[model samples]
Target: MKNIYSILFIALGLFSCQQEEITAEDHLISYDIEEVPVTEDYTVGALYVVNNWSSNIEEVPLAGHYLNGDEEAMKQHILWADSAAIDYFIFRYSYPTVNADNDILSAFLNQNTDSLLNFALRYNFAQMNLTKENTLEGQGKKEDFIQSFKDMIPYFDQPTYQKVDGKYVVNIIAANQFYCDSLELVYHELREEMSALGYDLYLTGEQTGWTPPARFEHYYFNALDAVTFTNMFNNAWYDRHVFLPQSLDQHWQYSKDYYMDKEGIELIPTVAPSINPKISNPNASTYIIERDTNFFWSILNVAKKNIGPSRTIIVNSFNDWNFNTQLEPADSYGSSSLQLLRNQTKKN
Candidate 1:
């Protein structure tokens, strides 16, 4: 009877040891589970700056002025943008003299804090030195365009490059200049070549002029992935001498209802602090929109309500001082615009 009891105790001890072994393997199994990669949510308020980095002057006569490509000045500018929740800057890239601007972008990217901010290229092909001889219809121009895309592949592949719907986003300024038939060919060839190189492209056309065949039809012939407006209002409005916020609101509603809702095309809306072309061209008229906090707050609310959270909201510029539309810190406004953007973005 004693031997039987002893044998039963030994069996229970062995079972307990086996249970401990199984528990040890459970943690190892858990560790084998792969962690999911963190990705930015597109539904959030992601702000982009249509940055103008072409300033040559080291200082302006105006207070709070700084050079466009000055590394130290840009560092502060980027810090302010980051604080304002700006996700990216679509640097305006014109041909020939873009090397300086490109260097500025490179400097920004080289910063350790650059992960909080990013940049993409806004190719200003119209301003580029392309003549009729080098247009898409002209010989060798199509190949030239393809080569440009190939050259950009390295930049597009960078970790900080902005992507929409899993494809690198490239905004083309002056899209109307490209012939539709030629553009279609160029689009297809670019897509094919890019795909072959294991990359995807999302081309956006910054279509100016209020007149349109509806939003979807805007890019029907051009074969672009999406369409957006560079300037929301017509030049006629600029000549009117009165810029109404109500009119802007009505235009927003029209775009939201007709273009976005009915046509089902992705729309990226632009919000300018003010428009003062006269600052650059003395003879030009000025259509000033007020820059009070309420001004940006109202526009942001309208965008949120109408456009939803899935699309990017573009600020007209970061540093377009000559045109008087910069959001950079100025001695006049201080950080008022930046504060407004940060506040509005947070509230929305």
Candidate 2:
């Protein structure tokens, strides 16, 4: 998905896990997967709270505890994976304060002990784009967005936990943001630069079939290695307004099948039970609904069936509350959602 900043070419594209151990007290909890324990190659985890989670600063909830809580989350996640024996998680940089080099992300990646979950970060060079429009803390603009991203590359250059083919495997996100035409121009440039730095790039997007099949094919389909479509069904009303209880996977099978046979693009299948925007300020024009656990697992099953070998299955999100497609353990379903994922991965 590409984001049209109105300031640029004006289109937009938009856009983890853990493990561990055996415990009796953990058994008394609601997360069904929490009770059982498994040891397999599967890794299932969630998006951790960002450093901005400290509230009113930038993002919401400010899950600062995740700075340390991730270890616990991993412990709990591993316990739940018992059903599916999940061993890997697509984790990302939610807390940049811990270690910008991804050292914070890698610690959990080691999985030195049993009943543990492994990880990789869905890193974003765009965070540097989070800076002020022209300065460090002013406002944002499309013209400045490019430089913002280029500046953030140093952080990801460091060695982290999980490496693919040797180097750290990072799901470089929002490569298609700003505008598909213009932003991607920046992407190729960044890709070249990052490659020179010896970093591997895994591009994810939703252009595979967002429009008439022709347009999708012409612009987005064959352009990248993986496509993690937005877990959203908004803007369906032809722009102006959006309605929630959004259909994330609506018509999703068509995409899964298309990417599988037609484009042969690696499908990073993302499944979210639902989409919502209630968590944001009242003015937020986005969604605000959580998903149903069963639906999420259904997508997981779909991913397992479609992807193989160089598998890079990307769940809709580990923590995307504002637009509401988070897989992290929350009050509503507790650990039921994660349990379903853990169980399904074991089958895969």
Candidate 3:
């Protein structure tokens, strides 16, 4: 009897250990990343809005403390943007629901100061899992999208919501993932619903479809008002151990050339200070792009020339801590990027 009990305990211990190992592996499972070398020279240029990935106060580390919707911290962030002449923020609005951390949106909306900044919603479609099996059918998925839009109707009515051509500007990220045979019908229905509710949406589709330019033109561009790249680099670039500056420049040029002559679709180019996702995801396969203010300025300058002043230029992010692409003040690089942005915007 004693031997039998001992054997059962050992078996349970082994099973628990195996479960733990599986969990760890599951967390690290990501798409295989590829890296390519940079070999081209880039021209220098001016800057656009110095936006950061604005997060819940809890995401930011201030004086060794994490803040969550702290009004003072939120105000300080706005002050930083104001000082840097950042026109507005592209706030990440995760779908299916808005989390409590989004209280920062309310803080921004409620502020009565003259230096208040504007914001537009960037729907994080990837996280929403709208493509999950059976999710696209019936009322569940469509209702979710509708409700998400309804929730933002109040924000859309606010004077500070960013607009383009007199319509509220909204960006859908990973829009390709949402594409299906019936996507056009979904969009049309949603647009009709939104029109009924008195909100005109100026939608921009980011990173749409597998085939660049072609799929985007055939599927997404017709539905969206404009299109843009979120990070301006292909997965091959991110797979490498070291990022080549020339590769980034070449990629930007290719993107610019592809969209420059497109007669009907508008292109909004994105600029980034760096690509350093390893800071948050240790398992991240890509390496950081060696960064300086010049790299950022040159990219913006090229984009401004290619897209022209009429189109808006989106900074990759202001506070995306997960991938370490934030332009916010950090312990290692405090306000350097912001100052660079300020200098460039002032030139404009």
Candidate 4:
């Protein structure tokens, strides 16, 4: 009996050692199993493209390829974004109000009555061929521009629409199109128009390149409340053609030092998980930025550190599958990528 007792004690000791080994491995896991704590230090938004409205998608979303005007998909996405601690989804909208993107946004707005997560609009000014040309025609177009803002007032009025500094937020893509001498005047006119209607607007312009164009002079800073880029891939500040971690670090500092530090304009830092447009554009460039979670963490670290006063960081996209930069879940990474964002955005 005494011998049996001794053997049992030895077995228990071995089991205890095995449990300790398992606990160490669990600690090595990168993300927190607990719920991500909500953050207020900075706000995170994502560019959500509505390309999945059509069929024949080669890439698979964890939520499946949803149909056009699918409110269910939007709900699923809103839940995911909320879980990831994303503050809003900036929809890529075009004019005419008859496209798939508009349909998606309409459906999303219909179901977003609860204001669970906020939404914003991003217009592609280049595609619209809209510019501030400083001519009689340009002056007429400024009225047209004001009308566009008037049209969007309904969207901006939504309780779920994102607001910063008590003004409705709107992002302008291809902002470099405003290369005319009257760029500042054009924006001033728009602001006055909106103000007359009792609607305040906060315009965030997306321009390519790092340094301010000589033509823009001080007018560029005067035109928009904040400046941002779609992504760093197209920005002309990088030394190497290939995108790398070191290049991004330098780019962020250069942008901050020149754009925000020198000029009083705020900078909404943009970051992307990956970049490979070949899937959509068959003739797309071979240039690609491979996906690396550690690298992504480094990016969030750098972006937060250099982010301007607005304290906003916009992810390149939530579901731009064509460019292969979607943050939405997939079999490849599941929720790990978003969890990284949630984990990093926490100030505490």
Question: What's model 1's TM-score?
Answer: 0.73
What is candidate 3's lDDT per residue for 1-348, written digit by digit as tens? Answer: 999999999999988988744442243222222222222222121121222343422234342333444566667777777777777877667775455337656665555266467788877755554543544544356667777887888879777778777788888777766745577777787788888888888887777312357655655644777777776532444322233333444445565556556645566767777766555455666555545776676655555544532357677666555555557787777888878766655543
**Cα displacement (Å) at residue 172, model 1:** 0.4
lDDT of 1 by residue, 230-255 (tens): 76532545322233344454565666
Q: Is candidate 1 or candidate 3 better by lDDT?
A: 3
Candidate 2, which ten residues in sequence have the lowest lDDT sum?
A: 238-247
**lDDT for predicted candidate 3 compared with the true structure:** 0.60
Model 1, stretches more than 4 Å misplaced?
1-64, 95-97, 112-114, 127-135, 213-222, 233-243, 256-264
Please report, in order, the local distance difference test score of every candidate based on alpha carbons.
0.60, 0.47, 0.60, 0.73
**TM-scores of all predicted structures:** 0.73, 0.54, 0.72, 0.79
lDDT at position 7, candidate 4:
98
Q: Show model 4 residue runs off by greater than 4 Å.
A: 1-40, 52-58, 130-136, 179-181, 209-219, 234-243
Residue pairs of candidate 1 with colliding backbone atoms: none
Please write out the lDDT profile of model 4 over residues 21-50, one tens digit for every residue: 444224322232223233555799999886
Once fitted onto the true fold, the runs of candidate 3 whose alpha carbons sit more than 4 angstroms away are: 1-64, 126-128, 132-135, 138-140, 208-211, 215-218, 233-263
lDDT of 2 by residue, 118-183 (tens): 555665445544422333223434334434344445544433344545544445555344233344
